[model samples]
Target: MANIYKILQELPNLSFEEIFLLQEKVTKEADFRSKELLKDVENTILACPQCGSKDFIKWCKYKETQRFKCKDCNSTFLPTTGSSVHWLKKPKLFLRFCVSMFSGNVCSLKTQSKEFGISPSTAFEWRHKALIALGQESPIFQGVTEMDDIWFRYSQKGRKGLKYSRKRGRSSHKGDNDFVSKVLMSKERGGELDISLIKIGRLDKSSIEQRLSGKFADTSVLVSDKHPSILSFAKSENLKHETFKSEQHGKKDIHVQTVNNLAASFKADVNHVLRGVSTKYLQNYANWFGVKEKYKGLKDKVKTIIKDCFSNNKAWDMFMNTELLYKDFILKKSKRTYRCPTVRYRKHQNWNFENAKRGTYI
Candidate 1:
């Protein structure tokens, strides 16, 4: 305190440019002092994120916050720059959000918006962003892996034509001409789980192979239901495959019960906790489910989430590239069935002069 007071006492006698220079020097010294104070407390070493150099010096301060300059790149940056939350405002709120998600607190976007005093859009974006980070961090599936496909209804919530369909509850059976979304899931018993929501039209052998290629080790035994796609995938990959009719009991070393149970739990979570997620963002929700299941048993899950939030820069890039456009969210004609007859629909179309001007008819 006396040294700071002496420095303050000498500052008033300096000119404007000299005062600026002195301020920079004081900031550097303060950074050194802070490093000295924290040397024994924090052992985590921080290197230059850009150049990967440790040869950096304190450059400036912003309201008592010290910034560093990389000697190799001659670039200045805050510690949070290049991190997942680099562009995030209200970081404390985001931390709290992470804790809530990690602790399995079932909070909706509306609830989060109210609690955090942010808009629902912001809450939705933040949730997906965190899910992206956690999804990228999901461990690889290995050992006795159980793989299966689960289905969710193609939903277009908060959009027109929702009233035409049944509100809430599962979609009609798969063969009923109802739109269904497919999710491929793999679980290593007592290990990691992977869930991938397929955006492509159907869940065929090719789609499964494309999405899950290189996911499992050749030596890892895969247990699955007798679905033809799964069987074909297992055969094509040359993996040791075991299959059972989904309803049949396991004979000895063959069953997809692990992934089956995981699928059931994941569906229940989406149905009850999330109150149904939109089909467009369903992949992100599935990712979140995988991450939640992955980290559920860890004692330091919160710490792990926070650490990943800072370190997973690629996750941020993934989140940025994930499109939330209306076109992507809307159900396609291939996934939907027209209720009315085509002739009758065309006859009843509201064609007008405006439609002619637009060179189209409804």
Candidate 2:
């Protein structure tokens, strides 16, 4: 640090072109450190990430990354399996990309891509992939929790061959059209919050219970506006509850200002900063927002963020399964909602290689 400080002491004497050149060189040097960061990426996991079984063995190496085989599930896996960083063709840049993504100032896809020397398309995919798993690390709701429901208009932002006009922002139509995206925000007193995509249209008891059941503590008091769904949910769960009128919205300390502010900020980022995104991917964005908010005021978070991102298995399939979630959450609930292609593929794959080697099978 002192050496860098001394080096910076000469910066005042540099001309405009010299400063510009020096900045370009510095950026390259900084970005190069991500490759160095790869050495610190060790497979510290003992249990199988897929089935949580500790009875596993190192199978083999594939493309220089170690692979593991679970005896229980008889499945092969990688350290980064089901992670946001999984299947990365250029993993050397992953740490650098993550740094830029979680750097407190969320940048545009173009900006992030330009900084990392990848296309905006890759950046978009990486961002959502990370969000899918990050959304899983929500805070537990307890005590005097403030709750509210926020809505976004139905949007097929990037879908092709759309038969109707693209929906943006909240619906102007007066009643529920079964097209709005409902995000339920529950914030605890000390700021650990749970922002979740509960359902598609009108917020109701069953949907809220599905997302938040057993999440609240036994003694937790639920506070919210006089929304019938919330009221019903509280009664069904036997939780202590409180309500606020429109006139008493923010006059008292019991206000839902925390979640309200959170909703506004998230809406700003989604509806304005990104110029809107598809409702199919809105849950991912909610997860992204929750993670960023969770990391605020933390002293050290890079390791925490990386761990959370890789905590789940088959997250890539889940990200790809958003269409299914959209259909199930908004449209009809399918019998195959939980069966992603990855699982289905494994079901049909041959596990016994010895027979093939002995010419018993091709």
Q: Which stretches of candidate 2 lie over 4 Å from their true place?
A: 1-46, 50-52, 58-67, 74-76, 165-172, 333-362
Best TM-score among the predictions, by candidate number: 2
Question: Would you list the clashing residue pairs of candidate 2?
Answer: none
lDDT of 2 by residue, 1-362 (tens): 37879888998999999999999998898666543343334345667655669999989887666778999999898777655576677765766677667765656789888888888878877787776766653456768899999887766676665556666555677676566667788998775788777666678798777667787887677889999999999899888898888888777676888888889999899888888887667777777787777887675566567666765454565665555445554444212122222212333232222321221100
lDDT leader: 2
In model 1, where do residues sit more than 4 Å from their true spots? Answer: 1-79, 82-84, 137-140, 159-178, 324-362
- How many clashes in each structure? 0, 0
Candidate 1 per-residue lDDT, tens place, 249-332, comes to 567868877777888888888878888877657777776676667778687666665565555434444454443222332333
TM-score on alpha carbons, each prediction: 0.67, 0.78
Score each candidate by Cα lDDT: 0.64, 0.69
